[model samples]
Target: MGGLTQFGQGLILAAGLASSAVNTHAETAPIEAHAVFSPQIVSGSDALRHVAYELVLDNFYDSTGVLQLTGIDIFAAPSTKPLAHIGGSGLAAALPPGVELSADNSLSIKAGGHAVILIWLALPRDIAVPRVLSHRLEFKTQTGAVQTVDGVPVRIDTTPPIIIGPPVRGGLWFADEGPGNAQSHHWGGLIADNGQLTIPQRYAIDLFGLDAKGHAVAAPIDKLAQSRLTDWAGFDSEVLAVADGVVRDFQDGVPTHDPLAPQAPTNDLTPTSLYGNYVILEIAPNIFVHYAHLNTGSVAVKIGDRVKRGEILGHLGDTGQAGAPHLHIHLSNSVNFAGSEGLPFQIDAFNLVGRGTEGEALNAESDMHLSPGKGKPVHDAMPLNGDILEF
Candidate 1:
């Protein structure tokens, strides 16, 4: 392995983790698993950064008899003793039922099935990550007999993508770490298969701003109480292109949904509704940038239009499946909206303002929410959960 090297203006280093792998096994157990994992995890301070990855298990059994996946045993490379045993039932506390760490990590060829398992291994800061991650699993039959399954291996990379930071300067923003913790609500699972790889939203992120007091919004205590677009900090805020790119595709005309307002019964969200009024930029040859939930009639660019970094693209709004006015953004390998694989990115520069949960960021006093983070300014680092980053 070569030594780490800095790339571009960002302090980020690319940990030769460009190599990826996939394996399938069905010999020992009736349930067959196929999976992929990123070999690299960005380093951080006291907290442990996770190496995100995914697993797909095809339960080859009928509905009459379902197999319950009990738990996963995590192990570091070159060591035999397990490091952590995360239970599926325990995962339900944090995630929706059915995926990895659900009520029962089980399988049955039936109406509702959890197609993939999205997971991340805890990586400590500055520590030499293991070369390969060994995950051993077990499944149970209805009769209570437990059958251990083969281990799923994932590589660990200590580097991250050498991408730049917020396209706009002096902007207030923070990453919402809650929504995508499980299977990343963005690129969660096998959305579309292009034969070479299975694309999952392993690194999708939502960006929002803080109120004058540092809260996500200054709304009423009631969850359903109305908060005008102007009342929220980021509403109508300019959405900038993150990099020099050409507008490959775009969407608009969808009316902005009123926040906290009761509405007549309607159909659930569709692809268009989920990402109301959006834009896609081909920043690189293979990488595409997606900006979702823009205010209706606020898009300034059009398809095929060449755009530079920090260029005005649109204004943030409460549209689609959004609860409030905020910006939803992510990088993908393909131009397919919510159908392609997600990619990780880094920012050029951003100030750490505060750190807290969604509830804490809302309930806490403004003085504390806007308080300076103890850590120094960050360059080329992936935003972790509960991080309130200011640009």
Candidate 2:
């Protein structure tokens, strides 16, 4: 695991520095360090492939210290062509402790005092095709105070990754545009082989538009099955307990943010911040399901609570880091979202509507059209809603 590797390296460095600093000060001074991975192949298709790598730095001394970053980059190349530089740069204070962070081209973080710098990259569809890609990362000290075992450099590599999962789940009712017929950005599709349906809403705002007063206003969008706009006050979006599992960890009162607004205003009310309400259910060994951007004071389950499939957990809302009101769901290997790996999953029995046709099955091997009424469903596929699914 990436966390294991990061911890091991951190431990070794801490030990090495202990002896050297013993005479200077009894109190452990924070060690400032940084790590940057060289770009490696991620996926290749049509003789061309995408590459990704990470740059991570930490201050081991202060639990909260500025995390200076450098050497952030990405490159792409064809088997028969020279490596073409895509784009990258050094990040200033890009990571903070206790937040979801990843090395595999998802998100980056930097810390400054008690605040953090978050950097997110959205991949365009042209470069997101399926293929095999490799990667490598390097570590360094900001003050030039640390070096590799051979006084050279520290780095790691991994085998190329096979991009086999669809970007989003298919089949489900979705509002394609914002209020007043606002334009919608087509994110991508979610695919499953079984008779299941997963509808991933890429634009949270598009799910429901906001009025000038920040209230959720339903748009004149097509509906799948018999689903309807749930009342905000009594809203309960039929949250299937996801899986027959126990609640391993949970936190409440995180305050929901307004999705209708662009960037979160500094003076926004705390209780209404984005990621307003959330839940994480542990369905099996090292597998947890996360649901974010729920309405505040809406969670009905708590830590260690036992729940079955199709149970009401909470209502959807505009919450943390969100552009608008929508549900954010994903499965991970660890309860700590930042330190976990994303796992592909499917939901059983939901109608596929929009763009092309109504009700069809989808899988990683299928190419779906983005036109209205063109989606499908998987008959026997299991839901990835934090449940341990079997293909």
Candidate 3:
């Protein structure tokens, strides 16, 4: 999802898969296939520039185990000439039943009647430009079982991403520190009680665009500001679920360290080392909402469990990838963090404090509050807190 380009022409490649048997009988077990398209660049004429994308396919199931893949097709429109095929190596393999691949090329074999087929695709350069490229994978199986899994159609954009309602309505507080103090800073995104992206930073980071550095430029902190240690833990925070979703993935129990702390001696470490306390919510088909930086032992959900929007999944604290205590939320296409692509979203309504009077809302174009300070005006703007705001 991250690699798609605006030029229309592109390539589709097969990644790999993870398989499992749902039923005791090998013949009746479901075939869960996962595929990944590693990052690649496409180069054509002067009019076209090299653009890269990463494609991931997860848990595509063939219940009857009847179909074997034949080939994959990608449909795309080019800017210049009609593009034909891509160039790159692909990966495919059989996975052990129920053991999903944690990363590309890493497979866990399990004892079960079911086998998995994994595919990886790499695109070639010199493809035509300005054409719509759609991927259609062909498969054949002995059982000819009908595929019953969800498939996301390729996206060509026109409709801007939408934020559902208001930010979660609750007491908003900032951990107090004197102005210009960097040691006690915090950061968080605003969400509605229903768990939609409503805070201005969400869109600014996800949509308004990125800077030359490729990081979310809309973040409240500049490079200098982010570098300040005191800015990390200045705000108190809590974890709120953005939508009704299943807890598909999680990690916890990692120790919190200062961002300025020295690195560990050994790179190989626990899952907690990287994620701290984290949760991945399957909000929609191939769409997952990720929450990170939770307090240790604060996770309220477990793998395979269900949660409602605005439910207390965990408490906010300094954890993985954090400078201080705050909630980091993002929508993605895959449960695996590295395999997923961020999706833009919006929240309904909330007062844009610091820009005008209280009870005002902010929109994509509105100038809203950015950082902690006093005497800021609150404006009537889009609601980002937990109140349901109608678009």
Tell me the tens digit of each residue's lDDT in model 1 across 167-248: 4445556566322355234434344443444453456556767665666667654542466677666778888888899998
Error of 3 at 76 (Å): 17
| lDDT values, one for every candidate | 0.59, 0.34, 0.36
lDDT of 3: 0.36
Q: After superposition, how far is residue 28 of candidate 3 from its true place, in Å?
A: 56
Best TM-score goes to which candidate? Answer: 1
Question: Tens digit of lDDT per residue, candidate 3, span 301-355?
Answer: 8999987777777765556655444455555566654323445454433322221
Worst 10 residues of 1 by lDDT: 1-10
Instruction: Report how far residue 270 has shifted in candidate 3, in Å.
Output: 11
Which 10 successive residues of model 2 have the least lDDT summed?
A: 1-10
Quick one: ranking by TM-score, best first?
Answer: 1, 2, 3
Q: Is candidate 1 or candidate 2 better by TM-score?
A: 1
The list of candidate 1 runs beyond 4 A from truth reads 1-28, 36-40, 43-49, 76-83, 88-90, 93-115, 125-131, 155-162, 177-180, 187-200, 261-273, 362-369, 372-375
Q: Decide which is better by lDDT, 2 or 3.
A: 3
As a whole number from 0 to 100, the lDDT of residue 107 in candidate 1 is 39
